[model samples]
Target: MTERATTSQPTPFATRQLHPAGSADVPWWRDAVIYQIYPRSWADADGDGIGDLPGITSRLEHLRDLGVDAVWLSPFYRSPQRDAGYDVSDHRDVDPLFGTLADADALIARAHELALRIIVDIVPNHSSSDHPWFQEALAAAPGSPERDRYMFRDGLGEDGSLPPTDWLANFGGGAWTRVTEPDGTPGQWYLHLFDPSQPDFNWDNSEVRADFETTLRFWLDRGVDGFRVDVAHGLVKDPTFPNFGKHPGGLMEVTHEAPYWDQDGVHEIYRSWRTLLDSYGVPERIMCAEAWVAPADRLARYVREDEYHQAFNFDFLETPWQAQPLRAVIERSLASNDSVGAPATWVLSNHDVLRHASRFGLPVGAPRPNGIGADDPQPDAELGLRRARAATTLMLALPGGAYVYQGEELGLPEHTSLPAEARQDPTFARTGGLELGRDGCRVPIPWTKGGASLGFNDTGAAWLPQPTSYADLAVDEQTGVEGSTLELYRALLTIRRERRLGLAALAEVEGLGDDVLGYLATGPDGRQTLVVANLSSTPIALPEGAQVLVASGELVDGQVPADTCVWAQVD
Candidate 1:
């Protein structure tokens, strides 16, 4: 499509609905390496201080060279940017801040030329309140066809003055916002799950279902290999719209049962999407869920054979850096996905919460907090980097697909000390400084050693300021340094592919201390790779005669150092 080529053939394992490629008979995504690009912070091409499509195109080679198989780009669709680009106004057009539709075409072409797959972000859970449908809904009478496309109901109090339910906004307000009719009188309240600027779509509406299906085809025809479905689990809510007794919480830390997410109807929508993806005939498209639901088994439902291809493993990402919890999450994820014949996707830092580097450095077993302000206790940077590197090495050797967020390879931590006035995340503004927004991790990345924007922009202008400390961790500075974090990532990726570790079978090796994790990755060709991660402060003895292929840190007398991981060729 659009002259960008793709490979697709009927795989012998038809039950999998996956196409095989490369020298190995395995599906490309089974153990693929996917890089996530938070568009606004990645690079700025037009000098307006915002990263765009051309900026991302200019950096495609960096991904190719780093050995990643694909790029899962964050939403660059036309939007109000209220929740960044997640509040999409148009599914078919590109945001001017990111570039035009033509630029998107060129990006697909360039990525295909480099043999890299392209995955675009699709936000079906909600649309920008400014979207045509929502705008129409605002003008139409309550209970009309326009209003039916979304959830609109009468307020609970006298004369419909209050919100429809007791549900609280995930961002700290009423989840329902009342609309004003043309007559200047108060109208029915509408559902927003997120910010007031982003209205949740009623998935039960046939028009809504048809519109999303059309949106999928439009992108597939443009040659996108797949889509990263934003808030995938939140698409279909309970028909009754029952509110929990307490104020409704966020998708992240819902330790209790909730009706707002991971509903059964959501699976039917994906099944339809899957059928539509297969309609293309040959080149099969893939979809990954950003579903943060309860229970390992509930999350697995999103990736059944008839639904999406991959689901991000938030369980693993949210687990503490300690060994046992991490090991348990991994085991549970593998078992859950294996039951459905789908690959479990792994991710660490994204355009979301604090970067794992800083997160690991924090006190172990602490609650997952969002913002670490200037007044917050600073993280141990050295310890964080050590753990981050070791964790990356271990993740690369895992037997499934993995996602790498930008600037993470260079050991970039969250810009925790950003001033309040500089904050851009809606969560911060809506919560009145009580909750730290995602802006810290979304800060502009450093690309070069010297420049006002650290080579991210020619004008040294960025929408979000880059922390001065980023100058030392710039990509140009880390490009060739042997022990640099960038090199560690490149080497780990190179070794992973060369050894086919992604397609290998994993067997947990016991007898390691409670604080240490070890696993054996065995290839079908008889090649054995042992991966050991030392999460404790004490060093652990390494296997004798297992030649070290690569390591996160230096070993002392055949002992794996604390917070270090090693990939060894077993004897």
Candidate 2:
């Protein structure tokens, strides 16, 4: 078996099949834990109420303690802030609000010093409407070469008055937007799946493809390890743009289906990208996709050996906290990715969704109808911390790459409210207020409990309000506490890195009870770890012949008493 050097000293033996002695070492991404940091909300320095590169640099020690192998920062490019930096107005330069290019360089250097690789978000499928390229297309004459950069078609009706297609925008509006010609003549329309402010680039156009390649090269040259591509599956759409016929249920399909959604040509595009990435001398650099589609099998295509390294496995996010349903989703995800020789990435919450505490039927502050109310009895802080540890143990023991959303280590709960005026997400406004706003999960990080604004900043106000209860959960407050959730994460991460337990192969996963979930991970070295989680309030008996290593709740006779989980080394 082969061995790779790690910064930490080795301790316990964990089963891992070291690659063949002379074979090329597997990429660092495999079995690595990546922490996602949303730049705007992580930490605010300079009293700007916005997190910047400097702020992130100041917090490297916190991330280092978390034991993550890498950090993935959300976009920090020049933008109009239409989509919170997702709409890139300039790909080469860092947004002044976030910091300068020099600041980014400092961030990279600092992160590496902490033994953490840095990956940035890249949006190749579209650009902000305010981007120069879009402006150029607007200025160029209709049917001109520049106009072809995006899909531009004339009206399709008999009277030349109707839209070219009935495609609905993913953000709930007409996908096509009309633009008038310079001479006041009826001009062409364009396609935008997200917002009208974000126009989709036509991959059919060679010029558009070349421009994106240049963008990729720019970042690779800048020393960014890799990218998390946004809306990757939406890059290539059906060329025919066929309208779906009426459904048997007599309802018009509001959303586009995946079969026609992720066009076959996308494979060629990703293959080309893989070639470019290889040419950069950074072949193992990570490339993950944010793909939302049904039937996990179809989504596996995005990560075929020559395509992306990994794509978001959202089955866990959509599953209820119940053990049976969660088990089914996890098994399906494992089976689906195994077929394609691709690794899966698991995440339960992100900047785009409600926090797990609320999603899992736990009381937020009080009791309401959704299993736990704001006023309903609150679970003890210790109980919450135990559950958080149990969840992490289960996630880390799973046979795949794990993604931890920012601030989850503290067991942070979702914010209850954000004034209507503070809501910046277009989805909330576009849906006519029907959707629960994502602003709740996007609250600012709590830096310290003793300071104003939870030490996130000394400024007037954070972009979003800090959660009221975060003071007790701040990093400073939990770092020294033995059983704190933050410390538990550090321990898990240390084990993953030192013993390399993350590289273990899944031996068996059974005992999926109504409220209990269990699995075993074993390496070729005869080391094994058993992970059992009590997902519900009721306690469950632990399996026999297990040496308890780490646990949540009380332990009795080598088993977790109840309402807790135990991570043990099987004898």
Candidate 3:
């Protein structure tokens, strides 16, 4: 394992003498600022129009300088490219489209050398339809061991033509797809909660469990610090094959009593994985769940002491931008995670969701569409960026680990006007364009202001076309520019690190007003930091004698402007 190092460079905020750190007492992830890199869009070194392992390695300095403690990489494993690499064809190999296994090793080594831990995505819930095991299952007879590895069952109708249950796929269409036997006769159907190209695994099968263990150790031995579990809540489904009753085109209406998601059996799998992680010894391996589970209490189960280390707080992400609703979700998230002795993880924008900047730009209570098209109503770009910065400031000041999506530091907004023909997400094809899908948010990151791909590759090639406006948001353009979103993030992260805000911190939610969200966080050293956001249309007064540390926007007359967030050191 690589040793951690302190940088000699000056921080944007006044650096403080923080309390001595204790690695054993508090794991690095507890208060970590982990950045998410959608590998396909991060950078393209070989210039094949797709981002790859070597490409990510070349850009490590960007993240290191951005003040992130670690990076959570999306999958680059061997795949058929169905569902954008979420469908794994070979769990142990890197896709040629990405790079060789050697490249992955080099990326991990280089990341560790920079004192940045690497957390890879582990999709245990399903494998690609083209996976070797799935191919074997296709040739095997019904009830065969190969078929037993997945959820294959007889259909409901007399002709065995209908799906076994009335479950709907999260992407679109029925959850089950009937397959033709090797003899050319229609056979049992297989269950897939997502796209049909991705088949769900039978977790009750010991072989499935054993294979995942091998996959985990493969990456662990390769020096990966941890994993971000995909579909973390949907692995173990009920054996009875119960119907969901209704078909929703989006995320399933899963509840604690739901047959598939958030099942009690899922915890058993996580507990076992936790044991495997512990077996790795010092500089502990961790797992973060991307589970979209229910109420705060239910979501907390995934992070119980013996289970996963962290679970994404989707409830917090789904909450509206209003002060009261945001505070309510924050309070519940903290209380629930605290119950399980785990730190709540906060996130604003990720690959799958609409970018928070654009989301906030919409009128309050407007529909949160998955994708934006040229004909769709446009978001107020200036308003969206302002609110996004403020929202991030508030998120970083809270008492836990925080996630920053790849281009979030640059205040990148979703490519709302992405043409339909340029979209590739399965949801778009499955829904026949009713839903624009996630392609808008997955555009390649712009590094330099001028190029065909805006400096994403030396050859100026990109898989997804970047917006013309990206020139203004390019990293080089904003790197040291005062009042730029990138600089503001640097300042906030610097303050957060110096104060050790994520470690041994206690937060007391202050009832400022219906339009203001305020909290006071006390670090272990007894230093108090007050975070306040004026989400209303009117400015709000800051606490008297509060030493301003960072503000998302300028303060007017000693008061925080509307749609602004401020972090101040208080007595």
Candidate 4:
């Protein structure tokens, strides 16, 4: 058999076949750091106290300076402002409150010019009840195809006394909404996983699936790089509508059927959308899922090559400020995703959660009666800054991509309290005001020190109150400081780009300490970088023989003193 033409070395063709070019080169998504901007609170150009597309466009340079490769803008689609714009009445046009469609186009153009890709949020899981399609369904004859677009049925018993199934809405109400048909029937019901105003689309219906595909194409045609799919796991629901059984408190538990909601068949839907996006000929376009599920293995499925490019790994966001738990989550995430053929994406906070500084103990202020207060004193602020920088350092040192929530770079803490009437989050209302509303985290970004609403806008009160102390933390104020969080972020981002970290490589994490975390990033070229973070309240000694490339605090002889992080070139 001539030994299959075996030579001293394998032929190039054989090697190529063994490791394809597509497998070798990193996806544009892997090494990129995505900055998430909540449009309603990012910046306001019109003095309306609401951030608009033009406002975002004007701030492009600031984002560029931050060293982010892309920006993920939260939904600005036309809506009635229910659920903070997640209820979309139209997917194709920009909301008039945010700006005109022309403004969106201009923002995209300018973003691309700055070499930053823009990804918009797409809410395919549901639409505002005010949407034309929903209105038509509401008036359609019972059992008509239009009504089938949503989950609708007659009341439970012949007497129409109960819902078909007992399921709780995420917003703390019955998931099933009673609706009177055009004929004035008293027992009709519709399924809405969230607010009644946001009806869940029936993905089982082929028409609904096709409509989403069209929606994806709509944005791709309009020059959007990709989508941050809202409630990606909520698209599919159990056809059986099984009851989740009561909670221990007997509050009529309803989320038990969640597993069925994120069915594997949903991949077929995502694949179809991916196919359309691929046809658009955009390079490095990405799709990320806002999935909240268990079994890291199951979450990994959403980011497989055939599904979304990435899924937000929210474990860190929920993890408390403890070293052991944090390390375990990171390790498990790396292991699970590596085995499942998907890259992990890390985030400390987002529009829905409390800011990192507050969550992680960065000085914001005393916890006021309404949850408002300055962080701790300067020492506490410095300690918090150290932790924030360390968190990012650890995130970047990991094997996959990392996400930076807007305003996080400034060590921004959550602002929980608002006047009783100004609070708009449903979480608070539904929980009988027990839940700390998310409005604080949603405050407008402070751009300049005490300069006209922190330069967010030239208007009255912002949609959410601007933090009174923002004057000190404004970007203009911190930009000049040598050891500011902003500067640390810039340095890390530059290092990420210059190093060309691939998504597939497993990081060798080690050197764990009681008040510090450390790891090493190893690339295909055998290059290695050492990362160390001080998780303590005071300064600590740094490792030897490592050249300091980036440090969150002052560097001393290639060492990072306490409450700091340093990225050192190992080889």
Candidate 2 vs candidate 4, lDDT winner: 4
List the lowest-lDDT window of 10 residues for candidate 3.
Answer: 1-10
All candidates: TM-score: 0.94, 0.87, 0.95, 0.88
Each candidate: RMSD: 6.6, 5.9, 5.7, 6.6
User: Model 4 residue 474 lDDT?
Assistant: 87
Instruction: List clashing residue pairs in candidate 4.
Output: 363-375, 363-376, 364-374, 364-375, 365-374, 365-375, 415-440, 539-562, 540-562
Ranking by lDDT: 3, 1, 4, 2
lDDT (Cα, tens digit) per residue for candidate 4, span 1-571: 0112222222211110100011336657865688999998888888888899999999999989888888999999999987889999998888888999999999999999999999999998889999998999999877889989988877687687698788777766677888877888775688887789998888889888887788787878888888899888778876777777432111112222353356666788888777777776648577998877556777788877767888888765566555676666776787677766667788888887667666556333333222333332222445555566777776776667778899988878676445667778775676676655578788888988866688888765588876576678889888968877777777778877676553323333334456666655545554556666765555555455567788766766545666566777654
RMSD, model 4, all Cα superposed?
6.6
Q: Write model 1 residue lDDT over 317-423, tens digit each, in one string.
A: 98888898998887788878878877778888888778998998898888878788989888888988899899989888887899999889989999888889888
Per-residue lDDT tens digits of candidate 3, residues 337-364? Answer: 8778888899999999988988889888
Q: In candidate 1, which residue ranges exceed 4 Å CA deviation?
A: 1-23, 245-256
Q: Which consecutive 10 residues in model 1 have the weakest lDDT in total?
A: 11-20
Best by lDDT: 3
